[model samples]
Target: MSFLTLLRRVAMTLLFILLPAASGWACTPVFVRGQASTLRLNVGQLTVPADARPGTPLYHKSFAWNRLSDGGEQWIRCADDPHGLSPLLLDSLLSGGVTRPTVYQTNLAGIGVRVSLRAIGGYGCFPDRPTPSPFSQRVDNPAALPRCGVETGLFPPDD
Candidate 1:
């Protein structure tokens, strides 16, 4: 079967096994490999917009994928379905289509399993804007903008 198809199957199985018990937990479980660290984490229900260039992928509604490393939580936003992971994703994750997201992972949702997230293209491409700005402040730090092409390893928006 295709990767996404297989992922869906896996997600369903995981949901059947995990959600019944962990339903009360604040986050859901998701598995990952080859990341050189923890493979599983509790995925939360919270979702926010994908922080990327306005017209970029994942610029739409995005879901957060949580990972616990060194006993701390790290969040990675993801895209909606058809990318492998549709299960484990909160209802909000599948609702919106804001940013244009790059297919970063084959498994986009499917928490409580080894599914990857595709809406996760907003790494360094998203700037960290300082101060409390409105939605207009979509980009990250202005000074850090240069880092996109240099340190952060991202191409210019115009490109």
Candidate 2:
């Protein structure tokens, strides 16, 4: 039992214990009644709005995620989204970093988000929606995105 070997064992044990907790603590948005919900990310916790109302705008100035990594804080909002989706927080979870914006539909009964990516805009429950077809069968076009019965004329940037 060398001192260096003991140190290594302790480090490995710490890693094994901390890794799962780190992942479990990762920020995730909260949804209410199948509608888009907002969350606040602090040091190591995500806080969901206590008074969230259904169908209201999900993103607000105070609630928006501030990109503090850069020199100064920049507020990411829905209206000026270059990516076409608002609230910006839900982007990665919903899209899975895919080129096309992933869509989830709220159930007819409005119980929760459906498992299927059947339509765009979370079936209108989501605040943002891409425009109807102009992009067709291309890797970099609106047509590539899933089209649904309801369209908002909003589209993400090409490629």
Provide the TM-score for each candidate, comma-separated. Answer: 0.16, 0.20
lDDT of 2: 0.32
Score each candidate by Cα lDDT: 0.29, 0.32
- Deviating ranges (above 4 Å) for candidate 1: 26-159
| lDDT (10s digit) by residue, model 2, range 46-75 | 233556444323222221112211232222
Index of the highest-lDDT prediction: 2
Error of 2 at 12 (Å): 0.9
Error of 1 at 21 (Å): 1.2
Clashes of each: 23, 1
**Model 2, TM vs. native:** 0.20
Candidate 1 lDDT by residue in tens digits, 1-159 = 899999999999998999778745433333232233333323344343445433222222222333322333222222221122212211112212344222222233311121122322343334232211111223221111221110111212220
**Cα RMSD for candidates in order:** 20.9, 20.2
Q: Which residue runs of candidate 2 sit more than 4 Å off their true CA positions? A: 30-159
